[model samples]
Target: MKVFGFAGWSGSGKTTLIEQVIPEITRRGLKVSVIKHAHHGFDIDKPGKDSWRHREAGASEILLISDERWVLMHELRGEPEPDLDAQLARLSPCDLVLVEGFKAVQIPKLEVHRPAVGKPLQYQDNPAIVAIATDVPLDAPLPRLDINDPAAVAAFILQHQGLI
Candidate 1:
């Protein structure tokens, strides 16, 4: 799968841009998957859910299936947090995979930036950032995009991955 990343500071519109672009990319009939990285703890399974109970009961892996979908939860009891590559390997195959965050990892990526926050740009020296999506005017060396233009962003990704 062709992997790309969306990275930026808090409230810089990374998620917003991705949300807009996903459906358009999918509409083009390409299989796309997304991986969103969260720094804080999050829970998809509630305490009383059967999957949660199974996990609490020490099942290392729990598989829940139905007619429409299936969910597999792998408990990380004592293992170190896996890196982006390992995490990507676990996902189902797709024509393209858009990963959000993991800014330090080397990959083709778009740096979502909003200068209103007065933060410095991440792509100033980060070659991994192949393009930038921002709400401000920038004279940076790399390609710049308007954060609200989802079609343009999708076009850049598709072209970069040769999916067009």
Candidate 2:
């Protein structure tokens, strides 16, 4: 799948922008998948669920399947965290895969920047950053976008990847 990353500081609207853009991108008759790198502990299974019990019982991989969907949850179990490429290998084929974190990876990236967030940009050292979606006008030579305009940003990403 074509991979793109959204990089920014916490609360800079990276996740929010991706959430808005995914539906619009998918509506254009393309399949999309998201690989979000959680910063802290995240629990998808309920406490009393069978999957939860299985995990608690030391199962490294707990997969739950049904008629419509299936989920494969793998516990790290104190092992080294998987890198971006390794995680990409686990995803099924799709038109695009939007990664929410992993800014250090060399994949093409879009910076979700909000001046109000008061954080420095990650694009200077990251040559893969093709554009920035921001609330304020950026002084850099790179393209800057209004943070509310998800369609425009999504379109830019698609065009930049030559997927449009």
Candidate 3:
């Protein structure tokens, strides 16, 4: 599967933009998968849920399946988090993999930027950033795309990855 990424400071709308772009991409008949990196600990299971109970009882991995869907939750158990390549290997085949974090990883990415976020631009230092999606025009040499236009952003991502 082809890989692309979105990187930016917190609250810069990376999640929002990805959410909007996913539909635009899928509407074109290509399957898409996402890999989001969380800096802090997070849990998908509740305290009293069976999955949670299994995990609390020292289960290293929990696979919960239903007629509709299934999820496999693995506990790190103090194991170091896997790197991007290892994580990517776990995903099923797809047309594209849009990563929401791992800004330091050497993958082509779009820098979702907003000056109002009060954070500096990442493209200056991140050579993997092939373009910018911003609320306002930037003075950088890379292409600038309007953040409000999900279709355009989707197009850019598809084109950049040679998906279209």
Candidate 4:
């Protein structure tokens, strides 16, 4: 699968942009998947739930299935967190994978920037950033895109990936 990324500081609207771009790409009939990196502890399974209890009871991994969908939760336990390549390998086949965070990983990425956030641009040193999406205009060496324009962002991604 062709992997692309969205990287930016907190409050830069990475999630919001990806949320919009997903449907735009899906509308074009390309299967897409996403991996979001969380900096803090998070949980999809709630306490006292069967799946949660299974993990609490020392299950290394839990596969929960319903009529609609299934989820596999793997516990790292003492193991180190998996790197980008390993995580990507676990995903089912798709035409594209939109990665959020993992800024240090070497992959084609669009830096979502918001000047209001008062953060410095990352692409200055990060060669992996092939394009940028921002709410306000800024001179950049890479292609600049309107942060609010999901269609344009999707188009940039497609073109960058050579899918257009």
Q: What lDDT is reached at residue 129 by model 3?
A: 97
Off by over 4 Å in 1: none
| Model 2 lDDT tens row, 20-109 | 999889989989999999888989899988999999999999989999999999999889999989999998999999999887888889
Residues 1-164 of candidate 3 have per-residue lDDT tens digits of 99999999999999999999999999999999999999999988999988999999999999999999989999999999999999999999999999999989999999999999999999989999999999897799999999999999999999988988
Q: Which candidate has the highest lDDT of all?
A: 3
> What is the C-alpha lDDT profile of model 4 across 1-164, one tens digit per residue?
99999999999999999999999999999999999999877899999999999999999999999899999999998999899999999999999999998989999999999989999999988999999999887888889999999999999999999888
10 residues in a row with least lDDT, candidate 4: 135-144
**TM-score result, candidate 4:** 0.98
Q: Which residue pairs collide in model 2, if any?
A: none
The order by descending lDDT is: 3, 4, 2, 1
Total backbone collisions, model 3: 0
**Poorest 10 consecutive residues of model 1 by lDDT?**
117-126
Candidate achieving higher TM-score, 2 or 4 = 4
TM-score of each: 0.94, 0.95, 0.98, 0.98
lDDT (CA) per prediction: 0.89, 0.90, 0.95, 0.94
Worst 10 residues of 2 by lDDT: 114-123
Compute the lDDT for candidate 4.
Answer: 0.94
In candidate 4, position 67 carries an lDDT of 100
RMSD of each: 1.2, 1.1, 0.6, 0.7
Better of 1 and 4 by TM-score: 4
The lDDT, on a scale of 0 to 1, for candidate 2 is: 0.90
